[model samples]
Target: MKKFAVIALTEGGAQTARCLQEQLATQGFKVEVILPQRLAREREIYYRKGDFNSTMHRLFREYNCVVCIMATGIVVRALTGVVVDKTVDPAVIVMDEKARHVISMLSGHVGGANEWTRLIARLMEAEPVITTATDTEKVQALDVLTKKVNGWYPNFKENTKKINRRLAEGKAVELFIEPYLEKYVEQFNGFTLIRDIESHRGGTPLVIVSDHTGFAKNADIIHVVPQLNVLGVGCRKDVPIAMMQTAFTEFCQQHQLLWQSIVKVASIDVKKHEAAIQYLAKTLNADLEFYTAKELQKVSQKYPESAFVLKTVGVGNVACAAADYASGEQNVTQRYANHEITMALSRLHEI
Candidate 1:
């Protein structure tokens, strides 16, 4: 819940202001109203009573945002001392006496006032006022990406500020992609996918399709940090409603592996709702996007039209090709399941 100091400019406005504050407070807002006149008897609210302008500045510093039941333009003009910094300012929103609508006049971007106004408008049946480049574009929050990546513990304030700076300045941020076997590199699988690429750096030399080594020191190539990432999957014969998950995890523990190395689970398009697979992916905090049966069918090279796969599922095959169709390549870097099936891993650089 957000804390707001509602400044009531007039005595008559205090009741309406308290009502509005309660309206927001009921919607999980902790609001403390400052009635400059006198605290009312019907609806008593506690606040530090004082000069409106100075008190508002103090409240602005104390709270996430401020809500006022008064004329916004007049309030803004009264606080000529408050707009000292373009950045690092509190979000301030003003609602009219009747609380018909909310206006985001100043500090719309830096203060995150626009989003707060939207929430306020939503609860009070008021219109949210928004006008900012990033908001207008509806950019995805970097925090969401941080949440999606298991290993990414972000420095939110610093990272977002730098990212925002780069975005504002139109700078390019480079990411590197590398895929290799964990046993070969002695590192986690798929951990090298999002490594930063630099002008020049060293890397674990790669062995080709076979066990062969390539030199990076003598080669003319830029330096890149390899982030390994692999998608491991197990599904029903034809992905029959999400049971493939148990088989996949069983495959993982059957072999010795931690789930963090696996990015997402996969299956033929028909397995989209496979319960066990979906639950497993959700448990691992990963995604279960599928490809066509023809994709994974490529792995084993021979999966005749199964009466089960065809009747039970629309897909006609169960080869690694089918998994690869949804995943990528015939790359079964790790395999399990009585040798009859595999919990394969695929690497992807981009969405």
Candidate 2:
């Protein structure tokens, strides 16, 4: 659930915040209202009159969304010191004490301020004030598009600005996405899809969606890497973390895969507590899945199996079997092994 912090200054604002909280709760949002000590009711956080700036700074870092029921000037001044790039900042919305209008103050697209503004407006029956050019023009922002497709930009700050600027101006934007990613973005409009990346001329703004490396070498191309690869690993009982990291890095380099494209790490259930596997998953910032030997055994026949592994772990294969089962697809690569680690790669059916 998304956590929301509602900041109210006066008695009227406090009443509006409570009503908004109750409405948002019906929609399954976890809402907390903050008020001054004199106006605070039960279950609300109260602060000293002079501590509003500090309270805003703390809530900005802690919550997914912050709704300030006060003057827009107060919110803009208070958040000036705490504001960061849209990628890391929380969605910010501002409303008057009477709730006449709810404004999407900052981080409208990537941080979801625009969506929240519309929801709050609907629940409160207030007018939503959104000034983002993409929303006004009914064009899809590149950042929002990547987010919807479960992708990440390799160069987010610079590339996003250029592509979104073209979109806001109603210029043509070309998308060169791999076939696997076509299904996810087929519903979105406002972009021409290029079937082949090599046929594109250099002058037009282009966005490429792929998991391959070296596609972002050109400065003009915006590359969104899809998180679709699943890695299955088997390691020695106590392999060093550094060695495991090095082995995984070299494996990706050898396979021409981008490490950022890996979405999950899979292993046998018995090795769930292994330090090296944990380190690899944490380093990749990917989901970790552990399958029981019985589950893995069902898919072990598809790959070459080791008699020693079957005797030790009750499964003929660990890496390939676990990856194939977890991904619900055949292993993309044959089993790769070094001195202490064995690994296999598979692709998720969707992003």
Candidate with best TM-score: 2
Tell me the spans in candidate 1 whose CA falls farther than 4 Å from its real position: 42-50, 84-87, 106-110, 141-351
TM-scores of the models, in the order given: 0.41, 0.80
Local error of candidate 1 at 234, Å?
A: 36
lDDT of 1 by residue, 73-103 (tens): 7678666777665355677888887767788
lDDT by residue (tens digit), candidate 2, 1-351: 899999999999999999999999999999999999999977679899799999999999999999999988999999887898999899999999888899999889888899999999999999999998888987888888887667898668877887888888878888888886677666445677889878777888788888877664676677888887889999879888988988888888888888998899999998998999999999899999999999999999999999999999999889999889888888988788996899999887664
Residue 62, model 1, lDDT: 86
What RMSD does each model have against the real structure?
14.0, 3.9
- Model 2 steric clash pairs: none
Give the 10-residue window scoring lowest on summed lDDT in candidate 1: 204-213
Q: How high a TM-score does candidate 2 get?
A: 0.80
